[model samples]
Target: MDYFATVLISSLSSASILLIATLGLAVVFGLMGVINLAHGEFIMMGAYSALTATQLGIPFILAIPVAVLVTMVFGALVEIIIIRRLYGRLFDTMLATWGLSLALYQGAVLIFGSVSPGIGMPQINFNVGDYTLAAYPIFMILVAAVMLAGIYALLTRTVYGMKARAAIQVPDMARAIGIDSARTNTLTFAIGCGLAGFAGAILLPIVPATPSMGFAFVIKAFLTVVIAGPVTLAGSALAAIGVGTGASVVASFMTSVAGDLFFFILTVVLLRLYPLGVSAKWRIKL
Candidate 1:
């Protein structure tokens, strides 16, 4: 029973990263209808940023916000330079963003080298007893909780969110009402990418700071993102956390790879049974 408890607790921490990481994708899909394959690149960039900050002698806590800021700036620049042009063409957007992802990855190789960087554990984990509880992972979960709550408040209480939702519901009407669709969408994408950056930074110690680390999580994220409905942030969050925890629990009893494969297969089967996603009926006002 203690073993089970340990796995469950650990799984919550793993799920926390996925929840925070994929929430950005959900926002972009919900607000702008843009399928950005480069979202994962934002995550990679952030991880690289954290690695850079640490190498420069910065503390992890301080380096985190810096990493997030750098990533957001990068994301905004990508929006202005590449993503903006492919506004209405999803296939173009996907292809272009993917191309950009490749470029960013190659650029990372040039700048940081292909070798992965290591992030240190927090000081508190030295006293975790036999529980295997990593302080950093617990800290990550707290940050994710704060972010999730903040997003809820924004979506429900802010004017910007309302306008974004309005644009999503009726773009033509939203434009007629003086909302700049282009500007709104750019911000939306940047926000999504920014969150990815934050997620990546939080994961600095949990995973390797390799250019490819983001790639692994991105595939896992996409599986849950689409399964959560290309829209619906909450759905994505729930699915991400759920899968994260589920995978961990399964892995405790089985091989890591097998656990992941089982979860992936389970997700596909769930999708087939409910093609519209977990909360599609509730979110889509038909």
Candidate 2:
């Protein structure tokens, strides 16, 4: 019973973290079909934002908005200067963003050195029989759940979402209806990057802020988005849970790195079966 409970908690924790990390990437890819390889840099920025905020003596809770705003503005600028021109050119966008990712990584190293301090995990724990579970993961679960619900509400109920959806699905029609497709696209990209930053803030304690830390997250998030099918929020959630659980179960019996490899193999096999991905037929307003 104790082992089962531990596994369950571990799965939930992993799933929640993955969900938050991938949400932004999923949005950007799903709506625009633009592969922003530099997406992980936004997450790295968020981690740094949180670290800076902590150094300034600000509470960790307030660092989230700081991270979001910082990344959002940078993302907006990237969209206006680079991404906007490469809208229809998928391969070009990927290559351009890949270069941008390298630049960001080196820039971070120059500015902050190779390693920076990591935030301390909150010092609360819950006893589950013979097992003592950290409260931080439970907090992460709540944060992910709330973020998901909030995103659903924003995409489903807001005017911006309506315009963004219209712009993506039918740009000519949207423009004909007086919707500024260009502006909508810019805002959507910023929002996606902002969410990525927020996820980084949430993960600051678990993973230290580092220039290259973003790559670890990018791989998992990319795999999740691919499995979820670009543009399907529901599918993203389901994929996160399924993948996190599979990885967690394997990690219990093997090394964490081995578990990651196992999950990667599983994802490849599954993709071959569902070529269109888990949510190929689904579309959301975002």
CA displacement after TM-score superposition, residue 89 of candidate 1 (Å): 1.7
lDDT tens per residue, model 1, 41-160: 788888888888988999888888988788777778888898788778989998988898898888888887888758766667633346556687777778788988887777668898
Give all candidate RMSDs, comma-separated.
2.3, 1.3
**Candidate 2: pairs in clash:** 30-231
TM accuracy, model 2:
0.96
TM-scores of the models, in the order given: 0.92, 0.96
Global lDDT scores for all candidate models: 0.77, 0.87
Let me know the TM-score candidate 1 reaches against the reference structure. Answer: 0.92
lDDT of 2 by residue, 1-286 (tens): 9978887887789888888898898888865777999888989999998899889988999988999999999999999999999988989999999999999999999999998888889989998889988899878888888888888788778998888888988989999999999999999999999999998898998878999988988988888888887546887888888887788778877789877988898899879988888887665543
| Model 2 bad stretches (over 4 Å) | 282-286
What is candidate 1's CA lDDT for residue 187?
71
